[model samples]
Target chain A: MIEVKDISKRYGDGTVALGGVSFSIDKKITSIIGKNGAGKTTLLRILSTQLAPSSGTALINSHDLIKNADEIRKIIVSVPQEAKPIQYISASDFVRMYLSARGFGISEAKAAAEKALRKVGLWEFRDKLTAELSGGMKRKVFVATALASDADVIFLDEPTTGLDPFSRIEIWHAIKALRGQVILTTHYMEEAQALSDDVIMMDRGKILSKGSVNELLKGFDGLVRVEGRKRRKMAYKVGDVYVSYVDRRKAAKFINEGEIIRPIMLDDLFIKRGVNLES
Target chain B: MNLRYVAGYAWFAGVHSVKENYPYLIAHLALPLSLIFIVGVLSHGALLPFALAGGTVMAIASDGAGTAQELTYLRLEYMYQDFIVATKTGPIDYMLGEIFAGLPWVTPSIILYFALDAVYGMLTLYNLVMTLIVSVLLVVSVSSLAFLLSSRMKHARLIGPYSLIFSYAMTVLPPTFYPFNYLPRWLVTTLAVFPTTPAAVLEQGFFGLEPTAWYMLGILALEALVYFAMARSFTRWREK
Candidate 1:
């Protein structure tokens, strides 16, 4: 539902935020994974039409971001990182105000807001002042607002950043239930593995790799687990054979009676592709 | 600009303004009431001009507070952007919202001053209505100017220093504290274009010579147009 074409953003002082980065996101969840300063936020901002790119363009369902910003805005909702709540307003009132501004009637806005809050497990706290809510709850409130807007595409930047483990899992499930395209950014590999149908790994403002989980795992050889009386070690290796640096006596003791032990997940393709198992 | 959306912005601004300034509301109302009493007692009818000027200043001050709060809470805090992104309302609607929100504070001070004038038998009903209308227009113009400045400059750090400099210059430059005859003809004409000049005119109309009401209304319309244009330009410029 989103197409990004050669989009690049550079600061005035010559700091390149994104350099010819391009990706397409459809109806499923796509996770953009990278370390700090990886241009993840910049890409999301451009997609959301919040910031203009230095060059190239992003399109949402064929609506060009630069030329059709108003239409793009109507269909795309973004939850920015560290988004502060509108203080002094109750959560329910805040939601109602946002929806009402978007042209929804009071009853419709209320029902949508309530449904979104319930999805994120925040329905009970709707009447409390948003400033009085905990950090996790605040994030959930933001999430609820985006969901209640009922936009066609949702961009979440580190949506589970401050949530506890349980809340993170719950949020993941809620995200999975969303009916439209989703582009999420995170530093957690586990989050990418669990929530994303496809992963785009970025480093230094460039796309290092973009593929499914199996395709990414193909870059590494099979994992080898060695359990000993005193200690255990795991080593990744290639082919049907697994190698480890151990004492000859220990190796012999484990390989008695001429019986050969084989690694279950060993594959020789990564070795042929010059992927170093040691690393 | 949709009326419902404008009403939403006005409602939001009113609730937030009251909440943020609730603790100081008592002090705010008391200060103007106290000033009326002090001038009535000490000057004994000689301080009419001063009283009118003081009331005009109070109206502008209260309106300034409201505009400042809206700028800090709505614009800088990103609440305004949320509305912009979600709604069909444009910059004009946002500007009008600020004007409507500022009316509460400015209206009360004007009403109180007129009530005081009536109690003391210092002003007629016809003159009182004219003064109130002028006060409303002048307040809207000044508050719009303040809001325009706030939208252009996002940081709150500069607002205080700017407000201080402008307030001092306006208080001295206009024929607010003294008669317009005390100033040069060219300077007097130049200052007449400013909102503070209309405020002074309104003050004088209440106390003595009544200036042309059309002139004051023209100045107000000009101020509104200029501020609205500035705000629209600022919004587009900031997007870059």
Candidate 2:
């Protein structure tokens, strides 16, 4: 389990990335969802021991983040949001080197690298340089490193961002198969809904809400979202688009009235709470 | 120090990277070979031994100083350092890894210089051993200084020109290609701050091509430690 207490980060430029936010994760998989500049990445960076918080601290499996970062690093592997593979390195070499750096012996690192490549469906392209692979394939090479690690916790920041729909689904499946606790950040509401056992929603530098999918969706019980050009009395306007929440029984009526109807989703909550979704 | 990490990272950033991009061998050789040719012609082959020895020092020092571009690219562009930072690996491991990676770039040049030394009848067993030791320390000290410079940079694009300038300045500004006595005593002292000066002096002394000095070895070793310590502290392994 991971416990966080009053973590905050303020840059030298006086930009506050996090604001004394606190949360915990005891579930197998938790996704932090937020628009751009929402502190999702900052919180992950701090918890992964890559970035220090301006105030407060966290305990990962009882290891203090600030005082025991080296110990904490032993149990965690992180794929930062901006990670890219070396252009001249092949997929197999990249993953194998990473495993070796994490202290796996030669033969063990090779076998684990092979297993991870196969798991991520990149075995056939293992010998190809990242420059020779597609952008999606290059991204998968890093993901394969995280999969091959023996760490107790894995952190992946926007692991599927910019991927095609099929590639995204493939990564989602790989992430689902991971054995240890997984924490990821994404802006995709469906990804959170599909993968997360629990979710944390952040806006600006603060978390607006956090709970299980079922618990967070309780307020929208028996309701569907109807999006259209015509504005309703209680609809939310998102840049020229108007979205209204209606009872499932009344959803068909709105659909026939030239409005699009869909099931209520995680983003609907943000819209209902008047949260800006520009990012 | 974890020998395993050093060897692993060495193979990854050094041997593996070199194998994938063989053009680096040519890139490393192009400048030094050209300078060797120019010096041989200008001095009518009288200073060929000095030029060859200087070429080895030049090759190794420039490669080490050029590592700034690679480190900056790895840190800012690929974010590879972030992956290593989150591991149990320490700053020294990363430095050695990077050092080994850079050492390979100078291999062809080192071999070329030694072969030329053999042709000129200057390749004694003792000199060969001494030259190798000096080359290794030169790579370490200069690369450490490069790492120190790279850690302060926030962008990769700015590193290319700066590394090129720094590489040439570290080598050419000092008397790597010429006899140290040609300069006044005070100038040599100032140039000693650049690792290549002492490295070149040691190599020249080892080959008996110039007057020998025992204290130059002490200076080179001391500079290596100081630069390595500074780099380890300044590198941003754990970001704020």
Candidate 3:
């Protein structure tokens, strides 16, 4: 649904934000993961038609970003990394104003906003000033606003940055339930693993890797762990089927006794694949 | 003219402004009232020129401050980006909304001051109407200028001093306090080049000296047109 071709962004003093980055996103959750200053937010902003790239082109549903920004705006909704509620306005009133501004009738906007808020579990607090709400609730308001807009594509930049576990899960589920194409960025590896159909890892203003979880896991060698008497160690091997890695004596003890070990998780596999967990 | 949308945004802007800056509103009204009374008591007729100049200064300063606050709040708080991404409203809608939003707070004080002048037998209906027209032009021109500045400058701190300077210049550079005849011809011509000077000239029309209302109105219209065009031409700083 979106095509970004060779997009590059350079600031006035020569800070390269995105260097000829290119990617295509379809009607599924595409999670962009990167370290700090990796240009994930920049890529999402470009896709949302918020920032113009210095060179290259971005197309939303076949419309050129520069030539057809208004049309692209109609179909794109962006949840900025620092998304905040419009203080002094009630949540319901803010949503209604936004909808009305967008050309929807008051009743229609109200209905959609109510439904969207209810889905995010914030309908009861609709009339409260957004500034009075907690961080999680405010984020929910922004999420609800985007969902209510019913745009063809939604870009969420760090949607669950400061939320509690429950609120994060709720937001993740809400995002999971969205029907349109979604491009989201986050530092949370678990979120990318849980919600995204595909993942794009970025580093230093470039795409380091892009693929499904299974495809990404292919780069790591599978490992087997054998737990015996007092000490436990990991045995690494190259194969499709799971193998039992243990000391010769432990292997004999385990295989002879017909015991089974659990499969390794992606986190462990990632560490085993020479990815520095601390960094 | 999409009055419904215009009204919606105007209502949004006004209500938000009131809620956010209620203290400023109180101050906005109180400061002027205090100044008007003090000047009225202190200098008899001598204070009229200073009061007029000060009132004009207050009006422009208030308008600029209010506009800066509104635009800065919208941009920094991410409200502006939300509106930009929303399919329904354009930048023109925001511009008109801001223009209408700023009028009510500014108009009442100007009218009240002139009404006081009338009660004291200082102004006639002709003066009232001309002053009203000039006030409207001033508000429109300042509002447009504010919007243009907001679009160009991202931070509010930088805008405050610049806007204050402009307001000061608008009030003092023209013959707002004293007679233009006393000033140098070159100075008068230079002042005439400013939109605020023409607006002040239009206000002079209320005093029985029909000073170029058409020219002032034409300049205001041209300025509004240029500002609106510039506002439309500028691209917002989006996520990309």
Candidate 4:
């Protein structure tokens, strides 16, 4: 379980990365979605014990983030956005060292490394230098390292950022199989919708909303979407699909000779609500 | 650093990294030995001990105690420390890893140089061991200072030029290459402010030629601690 209260971060030059943001979770995959500069990474770093918040308190399994950081480190593992492998080391050796540094014995760390590589379907490439591997493959090594640690609290930042569809699906399943409290941040809305039991929507360093996908879908209920080249105050041209959110009666009134009527998808709601999607 | 056994693994990891990079290890050994041998041959073997001591100090100064290029790469280029710090690895644990990583590669070369000197009939075990001790201190003190200096640089490109200039200055301008008396007393006393100077002084003293003062030895130890503290202050663990 994790608990956060009124978390805020202020930089030396006074740029606020997170402001009074708070949430809680217990053994479930919770995703934080936001655009660039929305404080998503800052929140993850604080919760993962990577960075200390300037104000407010957070607890991971009753261990205070600041006071009991050493204890918290015992149960957590994080795959940060900037992690890379030493060019000379093979992937298996990299994981082996990582696990060893995490307190595993030589035999145990090697065994865990093999299991993790196999789980990620990178066993064949385990002996290859990490630098020689493709970027997507290197990301798999990181994922494997995280899995091998078997930590109780895991934070994965942009795990699927540069991965292909198949590799993304593989990581998705890998993250899903873990029993720990998994907190992730991603730009892909469908991924957040697919993997998270609950999603925290953030904007400008504060959480704009938080709920299950179904609960969030409820907020757009009874609203009608009118499509096909019709320009109105509520009409949003989302690619080829021109969507207009209005009252059912208003949508009916705007309907013309040939047009489509449908309910809202997460993407539509995300665009309507103005969530930062570029980052 | 946390004394937990968990941190001990960094020592293991450091050694493993050095062992795996055999190509680097080979170059590290070959280059230093070749330079010492060439210098020894050119000086008609009369300056063999000076070359040996100078070359040992050069290797130690070159590796910067393990923090120079390695820390630069870990922080600016590969950035694997991000993962380490984000995981169970603490700052001191990471420092230990950096320290141990380069020592194994450099220590063997130091041994070889000492062996070469012994083959030249300078083999009194006490003097040999004392020279080893002096060389290790020079490595630690100068490397700590280098580590502290490297932390100020913001880009990876600056690493090469900065480290080269530092290496050249520590080796060329000091008494590592000659006897302390080669320079006048005023200049020699001024140069003693450098960690490498006292280091060379101690090494030459152990060979029974130029007796080094206990005060010089004490000053070298104190310099090592002070430089280590400065390096710790310069290191950045938490993001701004």
Maximum-DockQ candidate: 2
Looking at model 1 chain B, which ten-residue stretch has the lowest summed lDDT? B78-87
Worst 10 residues of 3 chain A by lDDT: A235-244
DockQ of 2: 0.72
Among all windows of 10 consecutive residues in model 4 chain A, the one with the lowest summed lDDT is A270-279
Model 4: residues with Cα > 4 Å off, grouped in runs: A220-231, A237-267, B1-14, B18-20, B29-48
Candidate 4: lDDT over CA atoms? 0.75
lDDT of 2 at B159: 92
Candidate 1 overall lDDT versus native: 0.66
Name the better of 1 and 2 by TM-score: 2
Displacement of the residue A127 alpha carbon in candidate 2, Å = 1.6
List of clashing residue pairs for candidate 2: none
True contacts kept of each: 0.16, 0.78, 0.46, 0.48
Candidate 2 local lDDT, A1-279, one digit each (tens): 899899999999999999998888889899999899999999999998888899999889899898999898888999999789888778898888888778889999999999999999999999988889876787788778888885789999998899898888888888887778999999999999999999999988798888999999999999999889998989899878899888898777886789999998899878988886873
Please name the candidate that would achieve the greatest lDDT relative to the true structure.
2
Query: How high is the DockQ of candidate 1?
Result: 0.21
| Residue B57 local lDDT, model 2 | 88
Which of candidates 1 and 3 is the stronger one according to DockQ?
3
lDDT of 3 by residue, A178-241 (tens): 7678889988888888888888877778887778877876644453444333333443332322
Taking all chains together, the TM-score of candidate 4 against the true structure is 0.87
